[model samples]
Target: MDPSVIATLTAVVSAVVGGAAGEAGKSAWGSLTALVRRRFGTDAAVTAALEQADTRSPEETTRILVDQAHADAEFERSLADWAGETARLLQYKHDVSNTIGGDARITGTVIQAGDISGSVNLGTPGPPERRG
Candidate 1:
């Protein structure tokens, strides 16, 4: 299985699990299961794995994804594609409000809009800055 695919699925699974806790978790889990069913309808193994993930803990769901990926190469590839697409779709659906990464600092107001298609980059311009 491709490492990138595995990584993508891992991330998607984590996001799904993170939302599997309270009243909000219930709603999040429901949405996730619906996505899985809609995308992989009639696939017995994937369907079974998704069912298990829904009922089991997040760690268990991660284990299931990894194990299944190892067991079936073709399926693993499909899962990676599905996971990447699903994650993107979910982000759009939820209207990703904010995202921050690395040690970059933000002290001023920042606004971003993705009307149709747009990208906002706040990374340091020019050469990388050295840190003491």
Candidate 2:
């Protein structure tokens, strides 16, 4: 599994366990649990790992997920898909603090953004400058 995926999973687990994810977080957690149940239904150890995820550190949960992914190619693909969807769903759930507080001087152009998708032009558009 990719590190980003692991990180996202960790965040999802934390949010869900901590009860800070709200409805969307609950939905994501349900989806993840369903996926695991479907994939590793007969594996009690896997199930136990997931059930006790909240009791363990995020790294431990990540390790169990990564180990499972390494063991099963199909599970890995499914997990990746779940991670992508969960990340999208939980994008805004993550706290973002873009503060320009306290004594701040004036600036020409100040842009503060998070998770930008498209191009951002901060300067006036003009003809290309000629060089010697």
Candidate 3:
């Protein structure tokens, strides 16, 4: 199975604020079953998916790593991975190039990270060097 499919599915599965990973755990199985049925015989597919909801099954449980625990982090990582994969898939379509011409430039200076938030602890200050 393509890992990107798992990643996309994982992102969707974890989108809810409070959700369980394996709640409706049939998605992966269903997709696999469909694929096998399309390619091979029903008997092979049936044998492949001997049990629908077996706890010991690695295929059924592997998705949990991406879908449940530390979901935000995992989903973000998965998203980045999938994005890279998609970019690779579309590499031939759009060439990656720097948009700014050699002479083109921004007139204003670029600001650093801590240059925006004002001050959190404003006890001592004199014409601040940086915003935060």
Candidate 4:
């Protein structure tokens, strides 16, 4: 199983369980459950694990899915597909909306960003300014 796939599944599960994904998250979660049921419905343990996702840790649920994916090639492919789709849906939920309105005045540089991972430099380095 790919690490990225695991990361995506973890994120989606966290978002859905945390109630932060909203309608898109709910839909993605539903799709995931349906996919699991279609692929592993006969397995009572798998179904139970999925059913208890909200109560159990996201990592645990993810582990169950990952383990099953490892056993079945087709299930791995389907799981990857579900992770990809869910990732896109979750991305939509995180759309950034930046706005400066209602008589807002700008003085200097105004930087707007979303989901920045590392340090952000807006300008070149300069000597410290002295105040008398």
Give the poorly placed runs of model 1, Cα more than 4 Å off: 20-49, 95-132
Query: Per-residue alpha-carbon lDDT of model 4 for 6-123, expressed as tens digits?
Result: 9988988888877788787778878888998998886897888778888899999999999999999999999998888888878866646689999999998998876777998878
Model 4 scores worst on lDDT over the 10 consecutive residues at: 88-97
With candidate 3 superimposed using the best TM-score fit, by how many Å does residue 37's alpha carbon deviate from the native?
1.7
Q: What local lDDT score does residue 71 receive in model 3, on the 0 to 100 scale? A: 42
Off by over 4 Å in 3: 1-26, 44-50, 53-55, 59-127, 130-132
lDDT of 1 at 22: 32
How many clashing pairs per prediction, in order?
Answer: 0, 0, 0, 0
Clashes by residue pair, model 2:
none
Best candidate, TM-score: 4
Sort the candidates on TM-score, descending order. Answer: 4, 2, 1, 3
TM-score of each: 0.45, 0.64, 0.24, 0.69
Superposed by TM-score, candidate 2 places the C-alpha of residue 117 at a distance from the truth, in angstroms, of: 13
Residue 94's lDDT in candidate 2 = 52
Model 2 Cα lDDT, one tens digit per residue, 1-132: 788888877776777667666677778878888999999886887787778877987678767877999999999889888877877778776545588889998568888876788999987799989998
Query: What residue pairs are clashing in model 1?
Result: none
